[model samples]
Target: MEFPDDLKYSREHEWVLVEGKVATVGISAFAESQLGDVVFVELPGTGDSVTKDEAMGVVESVKAVSDVYSPISGTVLEVNDDLPDNTELVNDDPYGDGWMVKIEMSDPSELEDLMDAEEYQAFIAEAES
Candidate 1:
């Protein structure tokens, strides 16, 4: 329900914050709520290459095990190392410390395909209907 206006979102529920060529990625607040209490996270290592739409990691919650997808193709520059041990951060602050990865993007143009906050709000509205 809390969608940040500055971030781009995927219909699959990932959020992206682009700063120059680097994109910090995370699941949206709505996504964390749907998944319930997160128990574990499996993330890609630094220096890993990820393709757009590809599975980059896994997040296991009390309700389900979900794949975290890359919103853009890039090389992993950083990952939230604390997430595997402290999963509650994903729920408590999805837009900040809950960020899953930071990647050096392969194509900035790919960002155009993702939805802005307003569009994503409409997207989820239609989805829940």
Candidate 2:
């Protein structure tokens, strides 16, 4: 329910924040709420190459196991290691500390295909209906 105005989102409920060629990825607040208390996270290592729409990691929560998808094609520059040990961060601050990975984008143009915040909100609304 708390969608940030600046971030782009995927139909799969992933959020992306692009800075220069780097893109930071995470599950949206909507995603975390649906999954319920996250218990563990399995993430790709730094330097891993991820393709758009591909599974890059898995997040296990009290309710379900969800795959974290890559929003754009890129090489992972960094991963948040703290999540596997302290999964609450994903619920408490999904846009900040809960961020899963940062990637050096392979194609910046791919960003244009993702939804803006308003569009993503509308998407969730329609999906929920």
Candidate 3:
């Protein structure tokens, strides 16, 4: 329900924040709500290689477990080291400190395949209805 205008979105419900060669990735607010309270996170370590749209990790919540997908092909530079102990951040600040991974992109142009906030909002609306 809260889609920030500056970020790009994947149809799979991931949000991407890019700065030069690095991309920060996370699930959208809508996704956290859908998943209920998050209980655990399984993430790839730094230096792991992940492809765009691939299941890179998992988030387990009260409602259901879900895969966290990469929005771009990249090697992970960092993971939110705070996440395994602070699952609440995923719901508290999904767009900020709650970010999952920082990736050094293998192809920055792949970002163009994603949707902007406005487009993502419309996409969510249609998916929900």
Candidate 4:
């Protein structure tokens, strides 16, 4: 239920942390909680191109498998190499070590379409209601 103020969120439940032109992406804490305990992760490779609003990876939990979508178009600069072997990180530290990818954004303006922490909280509240 913790939505970090420094991050932007996508409706698909992804969170983004922008630094320079690179964006670090991860599922929000809400997404991880909803997915339950993560058991496996499939991440895009470094140098891979990811499109805005498209799935870039998958996270499988004890409950179900879910696609991890990208919130922006870009070339993947790095992927969290530990995720494949330590999927539990997704549940243990979703906003930190549980991060999925870091992309070099192809269109920075696309960030305008995402929500801030307050907006995302409202979005989640609306969905729940």
Error of 2 at 31 (Å): 0.2
> Best by lDDT, which number?
4
Off by over 4 Å in 1: none
Q: How well is each residue in 1-129 modelled by candidate 2, as lDDT tens digits?
A: 689988999988999998999999999999999999999999999999999999999999987999999999989999998999999999999999999999999999999989999999999999999
Q: What TM-score, computed on C-alpha atoms, does each candidate reach?
A: 0.98, 0.98, 0.98, 0.98
lDDT by residue for model 1 (19-126), tens: 999999999999999999999999999999999999999999987999999999989999999888899999999999899999999999999999999999999999
**Which ten-residue region of model 3 has the weakest summed lDDT?**
33-42
Q: Give the TM-score of candidate 4.
A: 0.98
Worst 10-residue lDDT window, candidate 4: 54-63
Task: Indicate the residue-level lDDT of 57 in model 2.
Answer: 96
The TM-score obtained by model 2 is: 0.98
Cα lDDT, model 4, residue 117: 99
Model 4 lDDT tens row, 18-127: 99999999999999999999999999999999999999999999879999999999999999999999999999999999999999999999999999999999999999
Better of 1 and 3 by TM-score: 1
Q: Which one wins by lDDT: 3 or 4?
A: 4
Root-mean-square deviation of every model = 0.6, 0.6, 0.7, 0.5
Residue 85 CA error for candidate 1 (Å)? 0.9
In the range 1-129, model 3's lDDT, one tens digit per residue, is 689998999998999998999999999999998898888988999999999999999999987999998999989999999999999999888899889999999999999999999999899999999
